[model samples]
Structure formats: structure tokens, C-alpha cells
Target: MALSGEDAGETIDIVEPAVRMGSYLAEVQPVEDAAGLIFLLWAIQQPTIARPNAFVRQSSMELRLDACGHQITIVQTPSSMSNPGVTGAVMWDSGIVLTKFLESAVDSGRLVLQGSKVVELGSGCGLVGCAAALLGARVVLTDLPDRLKLLKKNVEVNVKERNARGSAEVCELNWGDDLDAELTEPPPDFVVGSDVVYSEAAVVDLLSTLRQLSASCTTIFLAGELRNDAVLEYFLEAAMEDFLIGHVDQSQWHPDYRSQRVAILVLVKK
Candidate 1:
């Protein structure tokens, strides 16, 4: 099947086969000169290929923070891919982008991290949270229960060993669940997330947790990959009821770290 759309003399076509034996391919093509359009071509499956043993091994990912003059090492377990339900074991592009954005914002004086209380939701691999802590923000890195082991290890290796200016503690924070006093005793000055808005079913629960974590003076920054338009739309629509949402333009992003497939949004409690 083929789907197409047009805007301002630019057109895009998404073509995919209606049926396939072991795998499928989806190709997105731009018919006109859409300068900023991003084309994605991906395979849905590769049943014939053997599973690699590397997928079950743990790998170290190093992210250098020029601003902090240090490198944070994150351990990524690709084995999580075997379990379709697991997403936090790997480092995603959105997480890297958000971490760099935070660095840039703090360096530019657009954001202040010194002694600020920050909370990170769905902090996969704890990259963003560790970055925040190194920038002098006392940060809480939270995720589902099963994700805490790896998250804690990352934080310990990067933040604790380096004796960063601030601190980070890993915690279990299932969305829509009762809020822990440690998370809300004083209400976080900022709540941040990356690649957390990927499903329509989780939107409501995510919003509920956001609402509970935020105070009237709180600010939220969320960075996400633009993979599912419907899921993002649903989240934004529901969030508007209690937040004043604003998109962070690409021009405002870090110069060396940006992508057309990723978006950053700022939200203030309304």
C-alpha cells in the first residue's frame, strides 16, 4: 500500500508492500525538493538472518562532556532487544540529543543547573540523568523496576566515581502509580525525559505521572524521536489540558547535535 501527503508544493510518498513472506520494507520518498524532509527506509523483519551473540553481551558507550571536561561511560545491553517489551537497555539518539541540549543550554545561560532539583523520567541507560548531575543538578533517575540495575550502574560509574558537582539516585517510577514522597517532597524544579512518548496507550499514564510530579512553577523538557505522529499528537492533546506547551526550534538546539527526526518541547504547568 502507498500513502502520500503534500504541503506547500512539497510531496512525500510512503510505499510498503501489502503482503510479505518473511520481511517487509517501507520506503519514504520526497517528490519535491523538501529541504528539511527526512526519508526513512527500514526493514520490518529479517527472519533468515541468524541472531548474533553480540546482542546478548553488554557494551560500554562513552559520552564525552566537553562542558564538564569528563566522559560518562554507559553500559548498553543489546540483549534487551530479544524481549520486545524492553526498551531501556539501549541508548537511543534522542537521549544523546537531550543530554547535549542540556549541556548547551546550561553553557549558554539559557538554563541553570547549579543546585537545582531535577528529575528524569524513563531515564534509559541514565545518560541524560548523569549529564544533569555532572552539570550540578541534583537529579533523580527513574524508570521501571527492572531497569534500575543498569541505570544504577551507569550512575555509579559516571557520577559517583567522578565525584560530580551534583548527585543522582536511581529509583523505580512506574507511571500512574502513587507518587513517592522522595520524588515530590519539595517538587522538582525541572522534569526531563527523552524518547518517552512512543506509544498511545502509555500517554494517559505518563501524563498522570507528569501532573503529579510537577508543581505550578515546574518546567518540563521532553525530547523524542518523531517516529509515530499519532502517538505524539495524542500526548500533546492530552498534555495541553494542564500545560502550556512550546516547541524548541532547531535553531535553539545544540549546534553539533540535531536531527530532523527528533523534537524537543518545553512545557510549563498551567
Candidate 2:
């Protein structure tokens, strides 16, 4: 059940909704009604829901930037393996918008990407790389091998404009398997991930994987959905051993649910 309000004590019970994969690339969405939301919750309670795309999509993340005046057409693939459509995985606040914001920040000189070889962990549709490539930064789109099938296809599909404009690489990166050789490049100046710390062990693995994939003093930028601050806090506590937790952006959905506001934290390697 989606907690509509802790104050009001309202939870949208979205456990099971009709799931259909239409066109190759459509969009992701949330449950529209309480019953639908409850159905989704029920469905997710089961163990089989490893991959959750907007099986019954009802919302989306807009990619146009009015302030920066950046325009990019992003077409996403079916919600299956790669598009892990949970709040952190594929929700509007977490996935598309967060990735877009991170990319825009990097492009705007906020994150300092003059000559950084960047890697996006769990790059579902490769939208982050699309924007990063536009700014002349070499980005590696990384995800699981099975997911990479559609990932490569999505990159080929959505990034025509990006590729025509410049260059980026699409590759397979399993967390602890073969970080250095698979990407076939220098250690990433930084590693970025969004909504990746779902389970407790996953959070630990994420840190260990980054330690192996980057330099001792490597920089890392992560945008979490903040399903619970505990996840961010857990990561921060463990991450402090190798790097400093720099800045964090925590966001909340407005009362009307029309827009999302963010509060982010940035962590710098010490």
C-alpha cells in the first residue's frame, strides 16, 4: 500500500493492477486510485516481482528543463528486467527526474565534469548518459547483462540525437563481477546511482562495489528516492569510512501530488 499521508493515516492499497507492455518505449507511472495502488502493493508483496516497470503505468517523469533550456526527447523501453519500477527504481521522483537533474547538474558545471570518465550504475534507459554525452563528457551506461540487451536497444533508440551530436559507450557492468575490464577504460572519476539502496544488504554491496570500481579518493554522486531516510542514513554511515557525505537532497511530493520537491545530500571522497 502506498502511504498517501502519515498525518492523515491514509494508505493507497495498490497491490494488483493490470499489467501490459505496449509499444517498445512508452513511459512509467504510478497508481491512480487507492484500490489500484493497493493492488500494486499486494503485487509487490510477492517475491516474484523482482522487476517492476509501470506494468500498469499511470505517471511519468518530464525531461524538459525550462531553466537550463535543454531539450531532449527520451523514449523508454518496456518495464521488465532493467526498469525496476519501484519508487527508487522507476518512480517519477526517483528515476527519470532525479537522473535528469543529476545530468543537468553535471552539465551546468555544478558537479565539475571537465574530464571525468563517468559510470552510471543501474542505468535503466541510459537517459543520464544521453545528457552527459551532450556536454562532451564520456559516460558509460552500465546495468546487468540481461538488462543490457534492452539497455543497448534503448540507447540505440532514444539517443539518436545524442549519438549524432557526440559519443558515449554502452556496456555491461555487474556490481562486483568485472568492473575494470568490462568498461575497458580508466577508473571512473566518479560513480553515480539513483534509488539503488533498496534492501539492507544491497546498500552494503553498493559501497563495496564502488570501493572496488573507483579510486581511493574517487568522487561519487548518488540521488536516492528517500523512501526512508534510514536508507540514506545507512549508506552515509557506511560510506563515511571511504568518503565524506557531502550534500544530500531530500524531496517530498506536494500535497496535491502535482510536483516533487527535492532535498539532496552530496558526498565527497576524503
Number of the top-ranking candidate, with TM-score as the measure: 1
Residue 72 lDDT in candidate 1: 66
lDDT per residue for candidate 2 within 1-270, as digits (tens), equals 123322246554433332211110111232233333223323333313323321223244323322112455444333332455322222334455455555555544455554566677777656566555555556788876665664575456545543434456788766656466645356666576755666666777677677776664355655544344455456666776765443321222112211122223344444
| TM-score result, candidate 1 | 0.78
lDDT, candidates in the order shown: 0.73, 0.49
The alpha-carbon deviation from the true structure for residue 2 of candidate 1, after best TM-score superposition, in angstroms, is 31
The number of clashing residue pairs in each candidate reads 0, 31
Query: Could you tell me every candidate's TM-score relative to the true structure?
Result: 0.78, 0.61
Model 2 / residue 55 / CA error / Å: 18
lDDT of 1 by residue, 85-192 (tens): 898898776787788888887887778888988999999789899999999999999999899998999999899999799999988999999899989989998899
